[model samples]
Target: MQYLNGKFQIGYSIRKNDEEFVYNNGFLYSYSDDPEGINEWHNYKGKKVSSLVDPYEIFFYEPADVVPGKVKITASPFWTVTKRGDIHFMMNNVEGSDKAKNVHSYKKASDSEFTHTTEFPGGELRSVGNDLYLISLENDRPVIRKAEGGTNDWTVM
Candidate 1:
């Protein structure tokens, strides 16, 4: 133990081979060289426990201007909801490759379900200005199409 800058300094270490030393902004530190070697250096803060939310049964919130409420769905989301102005778009997971479909109906309270076709996961939902679109790989091929709808009705583009 030693005192530096009018503060008590202490050291604790384990034996490591690969990790030689650690250097900070202005101070150089030397750790105890134990017979056992260390391969990697890690800076740990503390142990913590946390809970994760399920992707399926995720909740979608409506725009404040249009509506002020939250909606939850039990469907396994493929990617995530892409926004197009006042509208949100995404694809729904299904049984097989051609079983999944595209969905876009989380804009306003008056918004209705707009399913297109059998889409798959790993797909992307995009929108240009007010136009929404979806692109995905089907049958080992890349497919791009426009989402044919606005705030309510949606169809295959």
Candidate 2:
């Protein structure tokens, strides 16, 4: 299976009694060489994962495997010193959601990237793209890279 642009791609092929499936960039393909075999596939793009299957059902490609579970939420202190030597610090958290309460603060580095730090429920500092940051929930996990892309230059700390 492969994913790109927030879409899932799958492909399948069958030869004799053997069937093969492959997913690439939000497209699903299936092939069966057996004269009497059934060829099946689905395109899951722009659809929520919960809509297709039960969230509790465990599959070979379970998304929950990559996400975290509930934990005590804590906030982190944010501090930033721009290239110009200006210093700034603050604590920021989302309003309304319980998950937001866990957020400590965010630090901006560029228009597309920044770093977020948190201590409640869990502890981790995530670097957002090139200049902005946001708090992530326990079950929230970034996919990191697109399938078509060769690789991501960003490092996970």
Candidate 3:
């Protein structure tokens, strides 16, 4: 792995090292060895994506080994930043193709400190005014719930 100022350089092989899959506030840089794949770097803001840094962070994601119970949380693909500027994401208790995913909101006190604001079993996140909502499919019926307050504050609906 060759890094120029903490970034991987050309000729770096991901198979040989554990390079940071992502970094910066909301910048996601990925490199895949698939012959048909391309190495790309991009940033996403709101519903828009750009090659340059955007004005906001749509989502902030960090992956880790699954820890049972307390430490077992994940930041999966369906994520977004709320209008109030809090980072929101989803996770599952386990890993694999068919595991149940849950929505979770967390604020980063630092790079290593992620404190949960709220969590629920659902599929998506959307905000109306300043309130947060989660949607899920329960028994084949659509269920929606709202967060009661700021991050870490909620009243189950």
- Per-residue C-alpha lDDT of model 1 across residues 1-157, encoded as one tens digit per residue: 2232222222222222233211210111111122222322111111111211221112232111121222222243322222232334343432222332334333421344332323224356655545555677788888766643344333454
Q: TM-score: which candidate is best? A: 3
lDDT of 1: 0.31
Provide the lDDT at 39 for model 2. 31
Which candidate, 1 or 3, would have the higher lDDT against the true structure? 3
TM-score of each: 0.32, 0.18, 0.43
Give, for candidate 2, the lowest lDDT window spanning 10 residues: 18-27
Per-model C-alpha lDDT, please?
Answer: 0.31, 0.25, 0.38
How many clashing residue pairs appear in each of the predictions shown? Answer: 5, 29, 1
Worst 10 residues of 1 by lDDT: 23-32
Error of 1 at 5 (Å): 53
Candidate 1 — which residues are off by over 4 angstroms? Answer: 1-84, 94-103, 108-122, 148-157
Model 3 / residue 77 / CA error / Å: 2.1
Residues 94-156, model 3: lDDT tens digits: 332434334354543222324542245756665554567777778998887777324545444
Candidate 3: the clashing residue pairs are 117-152
